[model samples]
Target: MKKIYLWFTENYLSIIVPLILLLIWESCSRFNLIETKFLPSPSWIIREFFILLSNGELVRNLLISIIRVAEGFFIGVSLGIIVGIQVALNKNLQKSVRFIFGILRPIPVIAWIPVLILWLGIDESSKIAAISIGSFWSVLVSVVQAIRNVDKKYLEVAKVLRKDYKTTMLDVILPSTLPEIFTGIRIGIDVAWRSVIAAELIAASAGIGYMIMYARELFQIDIVLVGVFSIGLTGIVIEELVKVAERHLLRWNTNIYQEEVTRKI
Candidate 1:
């Protein structure tokens, strides 16, 4: 009981508010405060979710969306990192490419879907294209900023040690910018997921966004709610996974201060 209490205390932000909202929603449904036709209770939504799952509709759509995101994220992040490093290290390249990015970056990912669809057709390729484009800019900008933010002192130290250009970049610049790169990755993944959903909503026959849109057209509000809930829950899980990976990869930097304190103790 004590452990349960402690766990609740630790996770209150993630738990208590959602529980309260669920209870309020359930109460509203019970009291007929809202028309069930428009807004079903949380319990009804949960039941619909299970029904969809058992029929494999939810799982199939979810898998399709995940695959699209994974493909786009991998491609976008790789290109972003490579291009960001190249541009950051070369002043002439940065200046040459600045205008192109300035014009492109402000455009919303959804706006690109029509163009992408025309180029790649209303298929997985089009969806992936939209996701990649949306995610790429986010990651590129972050990586450039992170590289630029690297300490001058570190550069000087590297020079003092007579490190070659390759060594300096790999050891000093790369390591110093890892935290910000990971931040970019997190942001990029979010952009990728959102773009994929928008693409699916626009054209694809299978995805969480498609599920929600189809349910809405059929006036199955509970199923729409289930799709929304599933999307939100999946996003949370993915973001948490990214955070865990970030912590693991950057553990040397994150734990250095803690290690020093421990030694003192």
Candidate 2:
């Protein structure tokens, strides 16, 4: 009883709200208070999830979306980092890159779908292009700004030392800007992953987004909810993975700061 009370105290709000909502939802479904077509019960969605999983349909579609995200994210973030580095290192190229990408920045990932389809056709290439654009812009903007906002004192000292742009970028800017670059990567990957669903939903014949859209057309609310839940859970997992990578890779930064503090003390 004591353990139970402690557990409840620790997990109450998080567990209770969703439990109550599910209970209410289930009751509504059982009593016909809500149309099954519009809002299927929690149990129905869960059962459908298991059914889809057993048949491999859910896994297959999810894999397709994940693959698309991987390919596009690699292309986009790689380009973003490369271009950002060049832009920071060269004034002439910086102006050209900034102007070109800036004009294209406001256009959204979903918005690019139609243009991509028309240019590349309604195929995997277009879908990947849409996802890539989403990632590229996010990382590009973050990387450029991260460099621009690098601790001014370092830049000032570098300038006084007559450091060239390349030297300053390599010695002073790169180290300081890594954290922000990681942040950009996290955001860019999330954006690209999200774009996969929309790209597939809008045009493709396969993928998680297509599954949801297809289920909606068939009036299978449970399946639609299952797909949505899959996306949400996958997103949470992706975010946590990025955070773990960031902490691991930047662990040295933490040690350096601690050493500096200890010296001052």
Candidate 3:
């Protein structure tokens, strides 16, 4: 009970502040203290939300957005991990690829929208491409850094045991670098989600982004707000899932790290 109380206390501000702001907004709108044109009341938004929910439009659009994000994120993370590992293992490869990545990494994902549309015809392919490009660099950089930062002592011990490169990498390097790789994957998913939404806003016929864009076009502020809130909520849920996955996969490392911290203390 005490632990539960402490947890609630720690998280009270995060929960209370949002609730307070929402209540204030709803109150102001209900009392006509604020113009409904620009700021729709929570009740009005809730009604519209129910309407969209009943009609299944919201779910449909949400599913489409989720599908695009999943497709793009998986592809980007896979390629990024492979490339990152390769570069980290080979000094020559790292040097050769550095110039290209340096130039491409700084370009905003939205900047590719026009070119992708032209090349891929404003279809799912273009949107996926945009998301992939947006997420790849961040994941690649994170994985590379994680691999590079792996403790050299592990490699030395593996070598002393006559472990081959593949064995060493599988047992030592991959495990040691997993936490960093997972962090990168978390960030990559965020970038992919944002990039996919932007792409969908520009060209998609069915997606949360499309719904938001359509709402904006029809001057339905409530629908727009619903879409915004939906995005934020979805992002938070996905991030939590990633954290759960990280915990499961890195359980061993977590114990080791905790023990080391205990020793230090």
Candidate 4:
């Protein structure tokens, strides 16, 4: 009993809350405290989840959503990093583009849905474009800010070492700005991921967003809950993957405590 308690204490985060919630949910459903049709029990939802999985519909839609997010996120982050770095390094370019970006950045992501639909039509292109736009500005702003805020002392040291522009940027500026850039990328991806539902809602025939919409229309709350759970769970997994990659790639920049934590894991 003591060993079991110790094990649970060590792994509390991964277990306790979920276990409590599941117990409460199951009890409520068993007692009919809540309408089963509207809010199915965890067991029923799990059953529906397995049914969808076995039929392959869930996997197919998940893959579609993942593909859309990847395409849009890649484009947005690539362009954002390149443009932000160029503008930050060149005073003249910064002056030329700052006002334009300032004017354009305030427009909300959803506002582009209509225009994208008109330009690209009600297809994958439009959806991808919307997600890309949603991610781009956030990443651009973060990259530009990170680069701009780099320590002048570091630049001076690089100058003293006779580092060329390319060398200075590659060895000094980029390394210093990496943490912020990673943060930006994470935020941008999150925005892009969330925007998938809205983008697909425009006219998508497949994807998690479409599945949720269809389930809602059919009043299949169990399926709807499954879709919502999938979205949140997928998002968490993606974010953790990005963080792990970042930790591996930028291990030198990580704090000592974080490094120790990683080692323990």
Best by lDDT: 3
Q: Global lDDT of each model? A: 0.88, 0.86, 0.88, 0.87
**On residues 1-265, what C-alpha lDDT tens digit does candidate 2 reach at each position?**
9999999999999988999999999999999999987888889999999999999999999999989999999999999998887787578998776777777889888988988999999889999999889999888878888888876876777787787877766667776787999999999988998899999888889999999999889988889999999998888888899899988877766468445333322
* Structure candidate 3, residue pairs in collision: none
- Candidate 1 Cα outliers beyond 4 Å, as residue runs: 1-5, 254-265
TM-score of 3: 0.92
Candidate 4 Cα errors over 4 Å, as ranges:
1-11, 254-265
Per residue, candidate 3 scores C-alpha lDDT tens digits across 71-93 of: 98888988899898999999999
Residue 58, candidate 3: how far off, in angstroms? Answer: 0.5
Q: Score every model by TM-score.
A: 0.92, 0.85, 0.92, 0.88
State the RMSD for candidate 1: 3.8
Q: Whole-model lDDT for model 3 versus the true structure?
A: 0.88
The superposed Cα distance between candidate 4 and the true structure at residue 229, in angstroms, equals 0.5
Task: Give the alpha carbon lDDT tens digit for every residue of 1-265 in model 4.
Answer: 9999999899998887899999999999999999998999999999999999999999999999999999999999998999989988889999999899988889877788889888999889998888888889878988999998887866776777777888777777787788899999999989999888788766789999999999899999999999999899999999999999888977784466334323322
